[model samples]
Target: MCRGQTAQKSKRAKPYLDAENAEKMGEHLRSDYRDAVDFGGETGLRPGELCGLHANYVDRERGWMWVREVLVARRRVIRSFPKDEDVRAVPLTPKAIEILDRQLKGRNLTHGCGLEHTDGTECASALVFLSKRGRPMRPDGVGACVRLASKKAEVPAVSLYATRRGFATRAAEGGLDVFALADVMGHGDIRQSREYVQQTPTVRARVIAALGQAPPLTVIHGAAGASLGADRDQQPPSETGIEANENAC
Candidate 1:
């Protein structure tokens, strides 16, 4: 008896929220969750990383953030750690800066969560995101919120992690280096990050456009076929035999 399992080919791409769907989802989410969703999509951070984000991680002046820690999500319980035991900095774009500003605008709100430190401790603050009850946010809660918003937005159902995936895909499409993307995403394996650079409709369309830039080729199909742009002297006679009749005349 053969005692082996068959290996399957890896999927070229994973499903992710596109810009339009993300916007629509944002529109349907509650204000609190909307910002969280939008931020997750923009930064490509894991759900735990987003939930654990602290004000200190953001650098408004420099337009970048240090990803120092992440919230660990288990079944019905939450923990803390730095994802993959690695700390890295991710640069922010103008749009990301705008979103960060919006989050900071209401920092004084009584109902917000805090950060889970890498040392297995929780730090309380007017965190970037918080639960309605003023407690640290959890992945399950965020996931539930995403589901409802996607339904209301009438977009394809995608998980909260899809927001992160969307960010990676968009960044890759924007020509960001794959190795850099891996660092930004906190991926331990570069190959894991490469999966996000899968071929999409937009990428395919761009490829076609690029191929069209090549010079056009001309071909003669048959012995009597006229060459493209051929001069009168090199032209083939028409099927009507007009050239022969004219010569006879």
Candidate 2:
């Protein structure tokens, strides 16, 4: 060890937005934006992935959504693929589907990108979520909205990413396997998914309960009467190292 060097500190996991806090935040959010927050938490989608979701990618009947692209929030550019280039199919819960249905209602599925391009070019875009002005929803805008809502709701301020983390934490506490969680969350590395499953009081209690249900150990002897005549206060032959000599003789 170097005498002048300082030990590196481990990074702390970000606080997750549980259901109670989410409901509080929702109260202060606009109706449309509230749906976005709920949808994000329900599906565990990244902010870019959520903003880039399009009508064509949703399979309402099949209850799945294909994640194939991402919206770079700062630049407002739509990329052809999501982070880590991991295209995936995320299963939607009934609540998630309902949110999507509401957003899709009365919208032009064939409409092009609502935001005006700098080059005056209109590209094909049927984004599932948009601002009240009909422009594409940016990740930064989502974060700002979440922050403002949290402040108004008198809850700890959290970014849009907290919704994704919240989903992961809930899944972990619900006994979802880490490997499956990774796939569902579109994580390229399984270790990233394991961070959400780290030891907590709920997890510890589950472990204790499982241990209590384990079968009791049984001790088998060569014969039922093997030690019947032995001195009750004496140590067993095995413990005294006498059994080895008897077996050798």
Candidate achieving the largest TM-score: 2
Please list the C-alpha lDDT of all candidates, in the order they appear. 0.63, 0.69
Q: What is the C-alpha lDDT profile of model 1 across 92-205, one tens digit per residue? A: 878878877877785664432433344644555445666544455655556666766777877766677778878888888788778998989988899887766645345556
Residue ranges of candidate 2 with Cα displaced over 4 Å? 1-10, 82-85, 114-125, 206-249
Task: List, residue by residue over 1-249, the lDDT tens digit for candidate 2.
Answer: 331112112243355677788999899887867888899999999887888787887999999999877765444556665254588888999999999999989878877654333344465658888766565665655666777778788776777788888898888878889988998998888888888786433665567668885432421111111111122223232222011112210
Q: Point out where model 1 deviates above 4 Å.
A: 1-10, 73-85, 106-126, 206-249
Global local distance difference test of model 1? 0.63
Give each model a TM-score.
Answer: 0.68, 0.73
Model 2: how far residue 180 lies from native, Å:
1.1
Deviation in Å, model 1, residue 173 alpha carbon: 1.1
